[model samples]
Target: MKNIISTIAFLFITINLISQENNQMKLGDKIGEFSALDDQGNVWKSTSAKSDFLVVYFYPAAMTGGCTKQACAYRDDKASFDELGVTVIGISGDEVKNLKYFKDSYQLNFPLLSDNEGTISKIFGVPANKGGEITREIDGENFLLVRSITTPRWTFILNKERKVIYKNAEVNAVEDSKNVKEIIKNYSK
Candidate 1:
């Protein structure tokens, strides 16, 4: 009986393990090759995206403090990021409704993709379990897993040819803008 219980618990953990940031993406690596649905439920093949620069950021949850600040910072810096030929994108597991609230709350003007199915999360390798802030009761026992990986708080920069020009995967929000700007300054044509 103990083994049966352990097996079930382990299965849960394993399945949920998909969300963490695997970052198959590497510096100077080509743009993503997979397709994902946009906020409007429209299918987008990354190949169809036309931009001199692209900034794809993955975050953990919507409406949360840290996530909100990072997203809003990106939102507030649209012009500068744009002036440098950059397009910003955000991915998260938050449901569509919640995302709408968040976008409205900040009056953000960018595409926010919903990874509720976690396919995009797996592609970007953003940790599925974002610490123990969320909990579930199973068989009257509360199960908790540390996520602490929400959004992985990283950014990717791709040139017109879809080759990565700047990669900032370990930046802190307070200094992320500086780092992104620096990348643009150093690499812009």
Candidate 2:
């Protein structure tokens, strides 16, 4: 009985925390800034950030379909974002090696932040997989997926003031491109 009670309490607390993290809006939410190592072993953080605007996004894994599409979209459109003076930072639980592959494979122009211990992912409210096992599918084939359980997909548009001007909590990498474009167009300094 005591064990059951403790488990129930734990679940309740977990659910509440998930809810709070998942409900974050890109704008107006206080994002705790931290340093993440980039591909070249360079550390990127608020103190050393070099851009008029910043886009911080969290995803489930390194090379999944949705995650890939989203990342590639950003990769392919680096110039436009640069023209708008927006800097991009991507976060995931993948190790630096995997992040290197993802960047090299896609020729990602932006810095990929490593959160191997998932400490940073959790700080951003990115969810963890329910089971310890990470699984996914490619072309309808079963595969072992190693990433957090679920990531709260979001885009934060920080203006020159470092204040979030726009946020997209509901993420669709394909469809959200329009929003991304507009925010940069409007907020680009």
Mind giving the per-residue lDDT tens digits that candidate 1 earns over 143-186? 44223334466667777888767666675766666677777778
Estimate, for each residue in 75-156, the C-alpha lDDT of model 2 and write its tens digit. 8778888777778888876666557767876788888887666666555555545422345444466545354344556666
- TM-score for model 1? 0.71
Q: How far is candidate 2 from the true structure (C-alpha RMSD, Å)?
A: 4.4
Candidate 2 Cα lDDT to native: 0.69
Q: Tell me the spans in candidate 2 whose CA falls farther than 4 Å from its real position.
A: 2-26, 30-32, 130-145, 148-150
Model 2 pairs in collision? 128-149, 129-149, 135-145
RMSD of each: 7.6, 4.4
Task: Show where candidate 1 strays beyond 4 Å.
Answer: 1-23, 130-151
Q: What would the TM-scores of all predictions be?
A: 0.71, 0.76
